[model samples]
Target: MALDSLVSNFFWSNSDGSGKIHWAAWKNYRNLKTREVGTGHYIDVFKDPWVPAAKQFRIPVNNDISVNQDMVVADLVQERSWNLQPINRKIDKLYLDLISKIPLTSSPRADKLMWAPARDGTYSVKAGYRAKTSAIEGRTGVTRASPSKKVDTRIWRRCASNPVCPVCGDETESLEHLFLLCNWVKVAWFGYSMGIYISPRNIKNLGFWLEEFQLLNDSDFDYSKAYVASMLWAIWKLRCRMTFEQVEPSPSEAMEMTNRAMKEYWEVNSLFPKAPTFAEPEASYKWRKLQSHTLKLNCDDAFCKKNGKGGIGIVCRDSEGLFIKGWAEQVSAYSAFHTEMLAICKAVQLVEEWGMQSVIIEMDCQDLYKAVTQCSFRHCPWSLHGLLIEITDPVQNRSLVSFSLIPREGNSTADRLAALA
Candidate 1:
């Protein structure tokens, strides 16, 4: 009744009758509270009512104004319950976006979120290694095991304290440092940032580059983000190469790796049901055989498996297998195959620069070849055809241009050279 000074141990105090309510009153209380109470005993709060005179809160018989059991304090408390609706509202939308991006809904997207220990009192990291000897393939998604623990390390640097770049140790080892700041990485980043196919010569600070990254527009953001992610992934991969795999990728090799990664992610994600492939269905083109003195420059471009770095390889071989000349040029660009076709047009400029005459130019890229060979056509990136024609117009009469597909294997040498580019 006295709310402020209500004894918490009143039930225990009433055990020997030193409290406000008694044991005999409990039965009456229980009977009164019984209908409203859903389950469980409610009279455990009180014990005995026979104690010394110093402890009596009330006399039992005469003052019975009968307390209402319905108003019992504990009975007034509601059951604690959980509703998943609000949680679902927040998570369901996020999950839908996630599933839309990553269709395989079951895979764990976050490393820290899904990690669990094994039954053997050890982490699954060890269990995954042991699974290699079991009747199961260890690395696939079916194995229910992750890649080796070393692969999941957060900090990749050897010098963690006051750390500097591994490539050029002049700057601190951080994301911006390793990516946009370090001399070695900055050059490659700049090569991607600038329109140069070649990496930059020097990188002094990351702050300077961060400014550039912040200033990039939406299109530039996509390009720069892909470039940065690819380059970072490549750097991590190259570190794995040297540390775990005992193989190291050269700067150029690493740059190419970055290109391939970005390209692959784009192409693979583009193929999704929701995200339709942006590439046009390539049209076919007819080729006209040209004279030997008039070199047919068959230029093919390939983006690597990761980044979209442009590699253009040109084969100037005659009708015979005897090699005339080949040129492989690596361009730092995030554009897709159509841009590769544009690079071929750029290669025509290179050919003209070499002072070659009566050229029969060919490409494995059908859409680009068709667009270049024809005067009128409609295609996505339709404006490019005009640029293609304009680039080739000078040599159209003096030289002929054609497009055809050689087997991918036959094109290997050129492909390899292009990949190197």
Candidate 2:
């Protein structure tokens, strides 16, 4: 196709249509490409295809008064950088973000046309088929309602640009580097109990390693396939935040989102099994008595449904039922479980601060009691993981801590204090 003279000038000729029936189909795809700018001197600003971050490898027209069609890319270049003064108010915010991401070259060279779909700029028939298939079915396996009008933007960015890992400044971003090797991902993996340590040498490749981990879901292991899917989705969301919204990447935020994703999957799955969901479990109304030498600490959360505010109350008493120390305050919380967790952490902090040797922690929330006492936090709510980690950390050896569940009536003193706060 490159050796024919008529086909060489076929894309740019607008006046010739006699032999354009098949040529137009080729020209339509030819426009869906980009050129690597060298000096930015010859490329047309709007007419020519550039900016692979946008649709069709070109910028979209926005409804603005400062539209300029008679300009080249050189008009917006100053001191080897993009001069936003000429086009800041001329484009939409979404398109402006895409334009700013396009890197500029300082050294003088010829403008090179690039095939944006392939990893390398040069095109092949195999790459064309993969690109067309990705357009129909998404690269990340998300189901789309309308494939033609809506695009899988995450896959689009992956194809258009070669970017480094934003969380860790790695030189290259591959599947191995993105999921397994990055330091930020290591911290996230540690969020689960005992953690997963991946040994690359023992496995053949990434596929074999993931398949081995996935098979453990059906075994007696606590780790499940839902967590694997959640991790992949969370990592993709982190990349999207940096790519589209320009938000800073956060490891804690990523873990929280992963927990939320797993929770959503469990909730939907529970519907089929007909598992009963309850605000509080049916428990014995009696309160267990503590040892005469031990101190008892009671904590409760008073959450306001209207304003989403919460009151935390902590009361400590001796085995004789004599009040020793009481703390109450109003604070902001994400959910009722989160508020209860925050109060528990505060109670533990008070125990450590007071130098109490032996104490029994009591609460009205049965779900949290089981989560804390059983040493299993994999199925906890989204925001409670961090607090659970904190509560589980300081109690390793300093204080003898035992969790107990009580009815709302038995813990009325702490409940009243929480309401008063």
Which candidate leads the pack in lDDT? 2
**Tens digit of lDDT per residue, candidate 2, span 1-421?**
5658676566345554232322224464675477766666778877887765567767666655757887778788788677867878777776665555344544344566777776446667766655655654664575543452234334544563766766677645555556666777667767654377655465334465677877765684434677877887897788777778878766687788888987888787778876577778665465446687799899998987655578999999987778999999886664687678878888888887998878988898888887777655543542234356567667766647777887787788898998889
Clash totals for all candidate models: 12, 0
CA lDDT of each candidate? 0.47, 0.69
Q: How high is each candidate's TM-score?
A: 0.29, 0.34
Candidate 1 residue lDDT tens string, 232-258: 788667755665565643667667888
TM-score of 2: 0.34
Model 1 lDDT, residue 90, Cα: 28
Error of 2 at 333 (Å): 0.7
User: Alpha carbon lDDT of residue 350, candidate 1?
Assistant: 67
Worst 10 residues of 1 by lDDT: 102-111
Against the true structure, what is every candidate's RMSD?
A: 32.1, 26.7
Model 2: which ten-residue window has the lowest total lDDT?
16-25
Residue 101, candidate 2: how far off, in angstroms? 32
